[model samples]
Structures are given as C-alpha cells and as structure tokens.
Target: MDPISLILGAILVGAAKGSGDVASGAVVDAYNGFREALRRRLAGRKPAQTAVEEYTADPDNWRPALETYLQQADAQKDEELLASASAVLSAADPDGASHGKYAVQIYGAQGVQVGDRNIQTNNYRSGP
Candidate 1:
C-alpha cells in the first residue's frame, strides 16, 4: 500500500479501537506493529515516544497525539519515516484496503465531504 493510504488506514484502525471497536487478534497485532513502528521512528525522542505509548495504551484518548505526530511527519517531509510507518500500517490492515485500490477518485459533478475521516474506494466508476 502507498504511504498515505497506509497511514490513513492506521489512523482509521486506531480511531476504531478508540471507539471500542475490537477485531481479531491479528488486527490487534497489526495495531501493535503500527505502534512499534511509530516508536522506532520516534526513538530517542522522549516526548514523542511518550505520546506514542499513551496512544498505544489508550488509543481513543490519545488518538489526537497520533494525528499530531502524523501531521508533523508530513509537515517535515519525513519521507523515510512516512514510508516506514506506511509499510507497518499496511501490514496491519489485513484486508489490504489500504493499498489505495479506489482512494480519492472524485467523479462527475457531485460534491463530497468526508469530515474528519478516511474513505477508501474501489472501482468508483461514476457519480450522480
């Protein structure tokens, strides 16, 4: 999966977990992988690492921190970290929906708003 897609998927999963949406053990393991990847990226950065741990422990409460870190990475253009995070996140999304199979394909003349969430698409051929 692409970096952006993977990151977004990770955020989605994290958000779902925060909202008490628990999946199979594999999903949790994947989430852990995502957390470990974040930890590794922020290694030696106490504040960042702490934030990650907080999110890992209480994803719902600390989800904002994860978003902050992801935004920070984007602002800083941390390609390597983004790539690494994406890979980890993609692995975690067992359904492989994070591969951008149909992401961001706005069609026709309709308006769409995805307020504070992520949307994945597949073969979006038209709009009304």
Candidate 2:
C-alpha cells in the first residue's frame, strides 16, 4: 500500500476507535476524502449511500459488506477506489482480520520507546 493510504488508514481507524461521534484532526479529513471517493464510485449503484452511512456509524458490523465492494474494486483493478475502500475498512477494523482471524500481531517492548523503527527478535533463543 502507498504511504499516504497507510497513514490515512491508520488515522481514520484511530479516530473511529478514539472519537465518539465526530472525528477530529487528519481523521476527519481522511474519512471525508475516503467517503467522497467511495461515494463517487457508488453513484450509479443504489443502496451505497446507506451502506456507507452504516460503515460510518458502525464499522465493525458493516465491514464485510464494505469488503465485498473492495473486492469488486480489486477485480476491476481500480486502485483509487480500492484505496478508498481500504481506508474505510482499515478504520473499521484497525486490528485487521483475514479468514476470520487477526492478520497483524502486536508485540510489546519493555524499557524502550518503540517508534517507527522495525524490530525483530528471536522469541525462542537457545543460549546466550
């Protein structure tokens, strides 16, 4: 995924999980942008507005439905639409899910600040 999309997705998800009703900061802008993009794609298709609203209101419940549209966008090779859908989906399920399980793992670090740096460690080291 592109860096912009990734960041927007993260912000949107954070806002969705953190904000109560109205999102603030980049989250609001990102959500609006994604929604507008998705709206354009759904213009010809009815029930889209409702679906989008549902996603905005309750993402966790409507994620699967949104994903269906995402797949359609993928099949058509519509990168823009795909990114928009991905943004919404990411915001809906920040933890991310695939095949009925979490796709991303969260690891905690002790006595250190884990910034953007990537860290890998051997969980089962045999000897020192």
Q: Tell me the whole-model lDDT of each prediction, alpha carbons only.
A: 0.53, 0.49
TM-scores for the candidates? 0.44, 0.41
Off by over 4 Å in 2: 1-24, 73-76, 82-128
Q: Indicate the worst ten consecutive residues by lDDT in candidate 1.
A: 109-118
Tell me the spans in candidate 1 whose CA falls farther than 4 Å from its real position: 1-44, 69-76, 98-128
How does model 2 fare in lDDT? Answer: 0.49
RMSD, every candidate, angstroms: 9.0, 12.1
Tens digit per residue, CA lDDT, model 2, 6-114 = 3234433644653566554444554666656656666765554565556666766774575565445442355565555455544455555333222222356433322
**Candidate 1 lDDT, 4-111, residue by residue in tens:** 444545655554552345555555655666656656666666766666556656766775676676566552255555554444444445354455542344445333
Question: Model 1 misses residue 43 by how many Å?
Answer: 4.2
The TM-score of predicted model 1 comes to: 0.44
